[model samples]
Target chain A: MEIVVCIKQVPDVPTVRMDRERMTIIREGVESVINPLDYIALEAALELRQKAGGHVCIITMGPVQSEVALREALAVGADQAILLTDPDFAGADTLATSHVLARAIQKIEPFPDLILCGMQTTDSDTGHVGPQIAEELGLPQVCGVNEIHREGKFLVVKRLSDGFVDTVKVTLPTLLTVTKGLCPVRDLPLGALEAAFSTKDVLEWNMTDLDLKKEEVGFAGSATQVRRLRTPPPRGSGDIIEGPPDVLVGHLLRRLEALSILDEEDEKK
Target chain B: MRLEPTMKQAVIRRSVRKFSERRLIAAAVEMDKTEQFPWDIAEEMAGLQYFGLEIPATYGGAGLDSVSTAIVIEEISKANAAMGLCISVHNGVAASPVYLFGNAEQHRRFLNPLAQGKKIGTFCLTEPNAGSDASALETNAIRDGGDYILNGNKVFVTNGGISGINLIFAKTRADGKDLGFSVFIVESEREGLEKGPIEDLMGMRGNPVCPLSLRDCRIPLENRLGDEGGGLKIALSTLGGGRLGIAAQALGIAQASLDASIKYAKERRQFGKAICDFGAIQDLLAEVGTRIEASRLLTHRACDLREKGKKYTMESAMAKVYASEIAVEATRVGVQIHGGYGYTKAYPIERFYRDAKVCEIYEGTSEIQRVVIARELLKG
Candidate 1:
């Protein structure tokens, strides 16, 4: 059995400086870090690989800079790392990024039985990429998975969803989205970090490695677009109406009636 | 790779201040209530790794940085102050001089085992008349056939009662002034050595605080920390770094006080609501949080500057003063928040409040920190 883990490199928000003059992300001299949620994915993957006889391979898609994230994975315990990096992959949205990763995983020869990814990226916060990848690969997927218990050929999981706990069972070939409910990744010992330095180098793959037509990958296949991103226009400043309990209640009712929010027989009815 | 410390450094700092692995300081706070001297705590601190913070790997130490050493002292002090002071002074005065000044043979004989946490050491600087005034110390180490016979009494010597090694500073000068001051490392088995009975104190009572005297005590020639007249400089540098660790201890005490206050406010009720719900209590809580943060930032900033290999004497002195004063004020406010319960021994606030005062007196007094800052600024 083999496992594939997807991770992303994101800017360390605390260290990332803003360029007020140009109004742009000042990447120069700023540090990039592995997305925190990726820790859970890596932890889960390593645990599974250790219990079952298998290798956990890490895959990340970005520019040359993304190697930092891959090296972090190796230092933590991933057996091998692959960097799906190229200039042409720039400006790819979650949908396009997922398709590229799906194609790349499919090309891993002895394909992995399971793929694990973080539930969300700190920078994007979109949370759409993992599900899109599962759909693209036609694999059964589980999200918000906190734990995975092995039962012969299948895997049973404890998952969290909308104020309820769901136990889902899935076959060998599947994908999972992990959240904080999962165990935190262990910090690597100094000896392990030194060993990682000697053993792991990013295996860079270009567009040709995925064996995908230009029209079917990168920004070309993506279906979503962000017309423009801006701060939500300031909600006209909030006002507090203060008085005794009865007077405050009367004032709140008048305001709600003005907005037709307290109308009788409405949604509450 | 980014410029920031690697994740290992960001997470697991080096182990500088530690106790011996062979000995563990049993954590029994109640036994210390009768002013019991924590000889076991000192031995346990040596066992845990605080005795030889920077004495290199070859010397059998973990060889961690100053920041990590400072953190260890801080954590230990949070549980007990006497234990923390014992640790800081041993490393600062006893082990530090030998590591910094002793020759290869001296280091091999003394520094090696001490760094490895096998033994304890003491710093003998203060005299009956001199406390902060190191230059005025009158201890005499007169030469006698390849050995120096030491005479004079040292007061308020930290770890004086339990240490196996004593790094004593005394005047070798013909005149009775600060000049010709020399440091000697004397073994505990030396003849003519006297340890005064433990002095009574309101705080840090769990550790022994006593006077150490040298009456015709002789030390080998090779035991001197440096040539005559270098002792004062050595003392200043060691204590300069020592102040940083003391500041960190103060920060921890303050944080623990604020933490206790926050916990009590959330649970205790007043005026029919959890006191924490009251705006006045909320304001008090906010002030406690704010001061704790400020204390930590100042303490760490001085420590970080020291780690960068910069001159931080003034910064360290300022941190020591601010953190010490803040610990007292914060613990006082903590007691106030607990109301009548705060003043009682039922809670640890009363103990914390008592422990916070001595930080201002030791190392260099808050008044001395002012002097150092003023001198530094004036010289600039």
Candidate 2:
């Protein structure tokens, strides 16, 4: 089995600041890390490859600095890393990003048997790239997958949708976006990073290498434009009610009734 | 000329910090309360090569540099000082001596398991009669053809209860002639070897510090680490490096204390405002913060010197003394900042207080470290 994991490097902050002028994230002065969900995706790919015995290749589209994230993946048992970096590939929205990713995936020799991605990135939170890439590549995809089991050439994945746990089995050559609980991320071995930095090779593909025209890749290729970006206003403080359990319950019930979250009759009962 | 860590070192610190925070912190408190070595966590850490920080990769070790190795110990110590002590002693004194002095056969036989963390290792030099003055040991190894019969009681053995391999230092006797000091590689399961009960300690209670006694424990000739009578040289050189590890561990404890103190100061309110608002509290925080930074610089300096293959005996001693002292001081201030709540078991500050004191005592006492520094200084 040949698996390809698509990952992104995002700011490590919980609540990211926005660059209002550029209508993007403010990455300056902040530490960049692999998107948490994307890490889960990488972990899932590694686990499957471990059981199936195949090569695990990781690909990411970002600036040159994004190579660090790919190097990190390589340090943690990934066989190969592909950095799709090009100045023309900047300012790509979900559409252009997935297009470039899909094109890059198609360029892989022997063609990947399985494609994996995070359900969403921490910074963007669009949750659109995975499905968009699946659509472009014309392959089946499952989003928000929490469990994956390998049965020969098929993959059985479990995910919670609405209120029910849905177990779906998909054949080879499919894309899946994994969330947390797929697998626990292992710590990188002590010398693995130094070895990767010194010895491992991360292949870099520019827009020209991917045969992506400028109009089809970066800002010009995007269907949606971010006209403005602003941080949401801070939430007001909530009242902290401290008392005995019954007293706390009474106060909560009265507040819920007053807020129309609960009926007065129900509160009385 | 550079003070900032390299890219690889920075990533290592980040990775180890994440692992420590996620896995070790919760287990640390539990281990302290139960006084049991967390074998499950040890297995997890073994997979990540925590046991083989400085061992070469060919030997199934992580083969990290001194700086990176120190960073790992520091981060783990920050999360759990007892485990930190376990790793520092194992890598610094036990496994390291084998790699530094043991032959190729010894490397294949002993270093493999120790580096892979298959068997925890210990450096048993502290006897009841010998502590700071390592030369006054009473343990003796008698020659008997192909094997040596060893008899000694080693007390305060770090990782004694859980260790699989122990490096025992003893006086070698052949035909009633004393052959100074020699080190023997003794397995824990060897006959006539017994482990006393784990010590009930005030801090670092998670580590099962116990006494190990050997009565007629026979060790093969091949188990000898170096040339007979080379024990003192190996001990001195090995403990030089071990002191740096202790320094890193102390730095971690100090840093943790500072972090807890800062967070507590900002949140703990007294006299109608956060205690951090007062000038006195600010002074304490500032002093501890600066001291922790200083300790880090000294530790990192020692790590840098060791990594560069430079002579770092005095530097390591200086680092060890300063870092350990600061660790005690930082935790003291941490408790002071937490006030009444700190005295209780409610906060980790009190545990830090207990754990930090041993850093000054173990590996080498602060007074002994000053002796080493002064000797080096006068020689220079």
Which model scores highest in DockQ? 2
Q: On residues A50-104, what C-alpha lDDT tens digit does candidate 2 reach at each position?
A: 8888899999999998988998998988999999999999999999999999999
In candidate 2 the C-alpha lDDT for residue B255 amounts to 95
Per-residue error (Å), model 2, residue B319:
1.6
Model 2, range B327-376, lDDT digits (tens) per residue? 99999999999999999998999999999999999998999999999999
- Among incorrect, acceptable, medium and high, the docking class of model 1 is incorrect
lDDT of 2 at A138: 92
lDDT of 1 by residue, B322-370 (tens): 8898888889889999999998888888888888888888888999999
Candidate 2 chain B — worst ten consecutive residues by lDDT sum?
B1-10
- What's candidate 1's DockQ score? 0.04
Residue pairs in clash, model 2? none
Interface RMSD list for the candidates: 7.3, 1.3
- Provide the TM-score of chain B versus the true chain B for each model in turn: 0.90, 0.99
